[model samples]
Target: MPSLDTAKAYYEYFNQKNWDGMISLLHPEVRHEPNQGEPRIGLELFKAFMQHMDESYEETLTDMVFFTEPNDERVAVEFVVNGIYKKAEEGLPAAHNQKYVLPAAAFLGFTDGKISRITTYYNLPLWIKLVSE
Candidate 1:
């Protein structure tokens, strides 16, 4: 499948909260980088991170647009995250079911039809301000 198509499918799985389906699309050695955190290597860590995210937040991506090069090895996605702070995360504002809508972007690398790396970007301060209100 095309890289953009794969990215779309990945987001679809994400929006559906299908962790297994999302994991199935990742390479065994996939690397994940959050907006303001260290890069995590391997699928196991990625799965753990997903679990943590599931426990802390309820979110969905909207207004997605994907960009790719001719080789289709890399894909970039721009979207908005519509989320509610469901549970308190460590070292952050208290969760009171606060709703937030933030613009975000992600760059993905593909290897042999599987996602090799994913790096996401967003405004953390803006998110904090919105949630802290």
Candidate 2:
């Protein structure tokens, strides 16, 4: 099924920093749930969020393991985020290309040959500690 492939490609594009490629895999009405923020809706809104993420940080997902529902309607991926705080966005702290590695996961739903829902989870306090060091 395309679920696993699509999910893999999504992360691959992300690792490549191919923002447009990553966006291309999103459904038109995609909804994004961040680890510590309110839900974001629609492709355009997600695009804006991606733009902000791109500007604020650099990251790659590693050690990825994928799981799926029986009908492949949904997928979950667990991975490690190797990231650098390239710029300050949130009020967490000032950035100076600080590098950190943390565990993370994302749940995804598929629709119309693309991912329609993406919800991510990670440890905020751990990330803060890592970057603050």
Best by lDDT: 1
Off by over 4 Å in 2: none
Candidate 2 worst ten-residue window by lDDT: 86-95
**Candidate 2 local lDDT, 1-133, one digit each (tens):** 4898999999999999998989999998999999987999998899899998889999988999999888878999999999999998657988999999999999999998799999999999999999999
Candidate with maximal TM-score: 1
What's the CA error at residue 44 for candidate 2, in Å? Answer: 0.8
Identify the runs in model 1 with alpha carbons over 4 angstroms from their true place.
none
Q: Judged by lDDT against the true structure, how good is candidate 2?
A: 0.93
Clashes of 1: 0
| Tens digit per residue, CA lDDT, model 1, 1-133 | 8888889999999999999999999999999988887999999899999999999999999999999999989999999999999998788999999999999999999999999999999999999999999
lDDT of 1 at 27: 93
lDDT of 2 at 67: 97
Report the error of model 2 at residue 111, Å: 1.5
How large is the C-alpha RMSD of every model relative to the true structure? 0.7, 1.0
